[model samples]
Target: MLADELQHKIDFKTKPLGALGHLEYLAHQIGMVQNTVSPELSNPHMVVFAADHGIAASGVSAYPQEVTYQMVMNFLGGGAAINVFCRQHNIAIKIVDAGVNFDFPAGLELMDKKVRKSSRNILEEPAMTSEEYRQALENGKSVVSEIAKTGCNIMGFGEMGIGNTSASSLMMSRLFDLPIVSCIGRGTGLNDTQLLHKIRILSEAIEKYPHIETADEIAETFGGLEIVQMMGAMKEAYDQNMLIMVDGFIASIAVAAVWKKDPQILNNCIFCHVSDENAHQTLLELLGQKALLNLNLRLGEGTGCALAYPLIQSAVNFLNEMSSFEDAHVSNKE
Candidate 1:
């Protein structure tokens, strides 16, 4: 089997057994993902999905909702952290206006996959209708398909939307059967009073819909436009057998939603890092995954993905470039 072959090849490298630790596993996983012993990362891209949440108006986030579009502009101008890291690592980056409230000028460089001005306030009603949810999923698939046509085989998911953490928290609570308070976090640095208010508001929102049992229902109830789109993109990437690098809390929730539907997709995903968000580590544990880094990152612009890209490259690099014990004429253990 290919798994056996990959493991044997990895184990024969000129080093103590398991000396390379997680990098060896990463190489094996990447080899499995690409169906090759000598796997190469090509045309790596980071897709940032930006949107607006109507629940942002309920004091869930520290930043105002306009920061969504503002950060998108910062991304376009090469001023965001994601841009800097992608530039440093030579990875291509694209921004998608999934459902931000503000409209950009014509001829903007980003992909215009907007489904609406913004999602409906989940505090009052579902964040999106079934039709809107489907559209967002289609938009996500479309964006990833375009990237794949360019021979990109590895990509990361990032998100930008005020109150998106709220959506993610709510989804986590529902999907994991955890309390809303446990899932809630101080998004964008909420103070004590603000955090308490956020917890109360999200708890009430959960009360409005107490029986969201399925992934689709949870998503439609609380998923942001970019979150749903990211879920779609993740599913599409798994279909194409591409390596998926998932970012922080919001991105992890997107993966969680996708995983709930199709459990097999987890094999293609490499969680980049655990964020400082309260439940991020818990979410990772529940998913039975570990992140590549933990830099106390709470910023959600695909920064973790970009920061961790080189390590992924290192994994592939050593697998392809390192000599075997026989090749290096190194003595093997008796």
Candidate 2:
């Protein structure tokens, strides 16, 4: 079998067995994902989906809702952290306006896949109508398809939306059968009073929709536009057999939703990092996944994905380029 072949090849590398630790597992995983002993990452891209959340009006986040579009502009202008990191790593970056409220001018160099101005306030009603949810999902799939046509076999998903952590927290609670308070976090640096207020507001929102039982129901009921769109992108990426690098809290929630529908997708996914967000680690544990890094990152711009890209490259590089014990004339441990 290919698994055994890959493991045997890895075990014979010129080093003590398992000395390379996680890197060996990563190489094996990449080999399995690509179904090749010699796998290569090609045309890697980072897609940042930006949108607005109505719950931002409820003060769930420290930043105002307008920051969503403002940050999108920052991304387009190459001023965001994601841009810096992607540029540093030579990975292509794409900006997506999933559902930000502002109407960007023509020729802004964005993917222009907006589903709506912004999702409805989850505190009062469903975050999006059924049709809007469908549109967001389709937009996500379409964007990924376009990227795949460019021969990009590996991609990471990042999100920018005010009050999105609230949506993520609610989805985590519903999908994992955890309490909303346990899922809630101090998004965008909420203070003690602000965090408590967010918890209260989310608790009430959960009570408002006591019947949202399924992942789709919970997502459509509470997911931000970018979050729902990310779910679609992840599913499409898995279909394309591409390596999927997932970013922090909001992105992970979308992943959890997609994983709930089809567990097989997990094999193609690499959780990039554990965010400082309170429940991110819990969410990872619930998904039976571990992140590649834990830099106390709270930034949600696919920064983790860009930061971890080299390590992924190292995994693939060593698998295909490193010398074997036989090649190096090193005696094997008996």
Candidate 3:
């Protein structure tokens, strides 16, 4: 339950009654997350998880599997969109090799949490063995734990893996009990024929898992290395009471996996945006949540988090610095 006292503090702000609309709600939610009337934002970090999906070999994406590692190099060189947005906002960004196929030379600034070179193609078999899934979960937890130790209480998650949107679409269909067609989308610029092929492929892949009832099984059956690890990081962040900035569709699916296991995790999450991905709006509707923005954004490297960060700061700023009616000696509304 939210504290009644916090609600009172928000209502008593100097602005006209409810003038701030969702912003007031944003302030209250952040206040509740921190359990303080004067909540502060500190040490914001955006973590981008990179990996390769074996399903990528099934001709599901516009790009090659090598782009997974190539984009990781782009991230390290500070040339990707994520790097640009993070640098603009001064949010620290880190790349984790959750299960990318390539291995960088020693001394590269990256976290080596690879569980394997890539996942097993789900259409053919399980994406990963249970032990591998467990390791991915633990790796995610450790990464977030270390970040939290550095006084970072606000965090955002992103992912980069060719064909991962297929992985996400499959998980959404199964975990949320929706039709695979409703969950399908044009990931990475698929043409009409390619999109139809993707739907048929994923639909057949879903038939392979007839008995996945638990969260772990669902994850191992229909998740990428980056996504599974993201699920773990999300749970750990929620457990530690860290605010979660959820990116687009793939990131939302990761959060959904965690939420299915423990619904309370949604309390700390701020849905950053409704992605341009077709299934994203449906996913948000299923969660009964409103995203902060919708700029037709389909880029998925936590760009929504970066774009939304300033608004989050604004929420805190108004709560902490705005003039109260009494403080400004303004007449009360009649």
Candidate 4:
């Protein structure tokens, strides 16, 4: 698993040595994980978990609560960007309705693990009960375990929830010891006044919850439904050595939560992008991850992870396909 021979093979590729930069590094990492000099990357999966946040009542987001179900309907109707991009990359997409506060039609592929009708109002108390938080975490982990048993070696986790950004903002502020102002952003396009109000609301939520260090405590205090579940999924995925392609913003926040619980998971995870959200850069800085893209996208539908798929695929492709100079009978670099 040292990947030394693999590195040598990569170095001898017919292109200028190391010309591929991080792509080469990425390929090497994949090969080491597979314990193969030439690794085959396959069964890419994009799992988008949708839920609702009661904290939206506090005016944290620019979007209304109705957008949550409306977007899920769009996703199932194949009208969302994730649907389009997943088709382009040949990646199977799974949409999990982890804890949506709505009536999902029967017999759809919707997952119905409703932790509660909705998260608790954070203005007055913890966002979720401790048991609900643990259950959501287990639900998330079990979901990933099911996917892994089916031979998915690489997983992209994205989320959907109205007002989740507020939950994430509070979580980040606490986990990273950053000011509430630094953790909060203009989620879904709030004006300065609205952003300030959002910050105050999250600050109040954090202040209301008492000091706690465990993952469940952290989640119960400030986490939204899908966010905590996604954190559990990430931990399970890393334990399985499945590559974690993190989506932007809220998705990254969940990833950050996993990191707070266990930093070693970072080795198997890849940060996908820097979201348009101002808080994302600071969160990424706290995680010490430089994302692959900076497209300034603030959408939370796994669009960033879907777009980064090709680059990841190309890295493994070059590792397995590109010929060595000796094999190609080509001149070596001077």
* lDDT computed for candidate 2: 0.94
- Clash list (residue pairs), candidate 3: none
Candidates by lDDT, descending order:
1, 2, 3, 4
Worst 10 residues of 4 by lDDT: 209-218
RMSD of each: 0.7, 0.6, 1.0, 1.5
Residues 1-334 of candidate 3 have per-residue lDDT tens digits of: 4578777777778878799888888889899999998999999999999899999999899889999999999999999999999999999998999999997889989999999999989989999999999999999998999999899999999999998999999899889888999998898989999998898899899988888977788889889999999999999999899999999999999999999989999889999999989999999989888999999898899999999999999999898988788888988788
**Candidate 1 deviates by what RMSD?**
0.7
Give the TM-score of each candidate: 0.99, 0.99, 0.98, 0.96
Error of 3 at 258 (Å): 0.7
Off by over 4 Å in 3: none
Q: Tell me the spans in candidate 2 whose CA falls farther than 4 Å from its real position.
A: none
Q: How accurate is candidate 4 locally (lDDT)?
A: 0.85
1 versus 4: better TM-score goes to: 1
Candidate 1 residue pairs in clash (backbone atoms < 3 Å): none
The window of 10 residues in a row where model 1 has the poorest summed lDDT is 103-112
lDDT of 4 by residue, 139-252 (tens): 999888888877899999888898998888888877777778788888789998998898788877777766776666777888898998899899999899888999988988
Give lDDT per model, in order.
0.95, 0.94, 0.92, 0.85
Please give, for residues 1-334, the per-residue lDDT of candidate 1 as tens digits: 8999999999999999999999999999999888889999999999999999999999898999999999999999999999999999999999999999997998878999999999999989999999999999999999999999999999999999999999999999999999899998898999999999999999999999987799999998899999999999999999999999999999999999999999999999999999999999999999999999999999999999999999999999999999999999999777
| Candidate 4 vs. true structure, TM-score | 0.96
